[model samples]
Target: MKDVDRGALAISAALAGVAGYVDAIGFLDTGGLFVSFMSGNSTQAAVEVFGPGAAVALASAGIIAAFVFGVAVGGVAATLLARPRAWIVGGATVAVALVAVLAFGGETTLWRVALLAAGMGALNTLFLADGRARVAITYSTGTLVSLGLALAAAATGGSRRAWRRPLLLWSSLVGGAVVGAVAHRGGSPFALSLAAVVLAIATVILAVRPSTPERRPAAER
Candidate 1:
């Protein structure tokens, strides 16, 4: 693969892992709701809305709304920024760090959840190119499905490279969740801080002068 492709894939997988980490932290904090995984939250929201958990339903709706708002903000920022990849990722790192600080203050309520949602939402913009994402880093439902399909294809003699990226993305998420879950046992701050540190490292890696361009291939040269 080309240097640029490698960089994109690397950063994409890293952010996916970060998303999973933060999502796991959010799940633990919220007593079983997702920050990055909207589908899961949506389902829970429905269950709560119809069940006896009216308060929980309201919180779920708020989280969903906050996540959508964050996605919109991230998309606009990526469109307006001069260097979307670096700025978006870097901004997300900062956002997650703020969540860590807030968590340290014993504030793991809606505010922290909003920040986590925004951070992961911004992360999704990192791989956007020509209005299409090269990889989906914030969610893994499609990634898992694609991995399964690729496995079936490989069983029929397909190339291994065709499945490697999806597998890496999937595994990274699971690994991150494990780390986040373990860290959450210490405290919410610890979990958020861990995610922030990884995202910060990812930001630096993307900011460095890479041997090849890390932006979209079709970007102006």
Candidate 2:
């Protein structure tokens, strides 16, 4: 593959779609959020865990922190894992995705936070560990902001591929969010069911690709 495969880009967009919708529904229907974007959550969580945070901010932070811890767990899990092993990892990832929704499906509780966080972190970790970070499913707001800036710069005469891809990413995320919102508001079960299907397919595809062997983390090396 060249520096970046178009095929990979295509796949990333699809996954981003899923992430966008899944998270939208999570927030709209469940009264909480966690589609996969943790970076923002992490920052928000940090603000909360320390000081100068709101109630929702603290909760969001906790959710993000738990999700990150879950990511660490997924990373540890990845250590013993391989490519086709991606299916197994992906399955576990989906498990958490569902848990995130179901936990908030009804009542709002503290454990609900843990449930969503673990799932978000796990799912996000699987994608990253598999060398699929190009597929920015979670935290798409940044993607949108970046894409807009890129498009603006491109219109003004930028020549880099950077602008185009991010714009495309923002579009995909919007499309996904729409699909998710419609499906969820009409029937969360159906929406979730559809998401589950997409996730299963995406996971299997990733599994078929050879696992991108990673450089050992500083701790590992």
Candidate 3:
């Protein structure tokens, strides 16, 4: 977060919100499955393998595979495209929009969940620095860890403001999840459409904004 520019940080926060929103919807719709938090899905899969059956475990495995595939696609796009952030966000927008369409069309839950997971996978590629994602938008565990470290550093006379970004990211995700839960309860049918609209707007902003040059790690420099 300290290394990222203001514009990039804002975009990353917004993306995190989207991730939380979608994840909430997916959780409710699937009744315990996750769309973005692969760690949770992995644990669930492991438990299901022993508890429920292979068939239940396979669902999480499939979502994980889809996420990996989306990451591969986004990684290639990042390497090849001039405006990788915009294009990657655009790709995510498309995936999310498709989920909304399928939901309206009464499509099966499996495809919707898969697409949600894939969109989130692509979203994580939006802010790469030195061949790694600078921000993990869909998950809060890492952000919380960073927050704790930043707070510790501050107590030890490090930069006092270093914790702000991590806090902001985590707060945004929680806020989005709250909104998503309310929307899902009130307007369940339109919850996904709302997410798609948010992503579409983000795509436009990323497309028009000047690209930020990738910052290399100190060792590389």
Worst 10 residues of 2 by lDDT: 212-221
Show where candidate 3 strays beyond 4 Å.
186-189, 212-221
Is 1 or 3 the stronger prediction by TM-score? 3
Q: Write the per-residue lDDT of candidate 3 for residues 1-221, one digit (tens) a residue.
A: 67677988998999899889988888888878888889988988998897756776888898898888888888888888888888888899888888877777663477679988988898888777667877878879989999999999999999898899999999988888888888888544588889989999998998888664543446743
Candidate 1 residues lying further than 4 Å off, grouped into runs, are 1-4, 210-214, 217-221
Clashes of 2: 1
Whose lDDT is greatest here?
A: 3
Clashing pairs in 1: none
Error of 2 at 53 (Å): 10
Positional deviation of residue 132's Cα in model 1 after best superposition, in angstroms: 3.0
Cα RMSD, model 3: 2.0
TM-score of each: 0.89, 0.68, 0.93
> What order do you get sorting by TM-score, best first?
3, 1, 2
Residue 25 CA error for candidate 2 (Å)? 1.4
**1 or 2, greater by TM-score:** 1
Q: What is the C-alpha lDDT of each candidate?
A: 0.78, 0.61, 0.83
Q: How many residue pairs clash in each candidate?
A: 0, 1, 0
Error of 3 at 25 (Å): 0.5
